[model samples]
Target: MTQRFMRATGRLRIIFGPAHSSSLDHEMTEENQRLLKQRQAEAQQWETIRRPDGSTYVVPKNPEDKSLR
Candidate 1:
């Protein structure tokens, strides 16, 4: 069997720079890292449940859709 890996891919942009400016690193700052971790954590909370009817459904991490507490 072959093993597969999931990767996160994205493009880089300079939010406040000129058109000729260089691109920024994806996870360049502490705040960016924090946000990435937060998003990944939230995504992991989701689940894919399979039913006896041979159907699969995705369930949200917070089924109640509550605010981030």
Candidate 2:
């Protein structure tokens, strides 16, 4: 077919597909893993305490209350 003849009959086409996401959670480095573990250890030290007045308080299980600062 001639180029001009083909161009006169050609129609546009559109294709769609599912959306995708790329995640970096699986790409942790050794230093990132170590820091995550350390932070988890520190978070484990938090405690929820109840008082005689029925008030609630959150404090570190350790003597130092870092959250207060």
State which candidate has the highest lDDT.
Answer: 2
Per-residue lDDT, model 2, residue 20, is 42
Cα lDDT computed for each candidate against the true fold: 0.60, 0.67
How does residue 6 of candidate 2 score in lDDT? Answer: 42
The residue-by-residue lDDT of candidate 2 on 1-69, one tens digit each, is 345554554442123432343454578889999999888877788888999999998887877656533
Cα distance off (Å), candidate 2, residue 18: 21
TM-score (C-alpha) between model 2 and the true structure: 0.41
Candidate 1 structure quality by residue, lDDT tens digits, 1-69:
111111111122243332343445454689878998999877777888999999999887677865553
TM-score of each: 0.41, 0.41
Runs in model 1 deviating more than 4 A are 1-20, 24-27, 49-57, 61-69
CA RMSD per model (angstroms): 11.0, 15.1
| Model 2 C-alpha lDDT versus the unseen true structure | 0.67
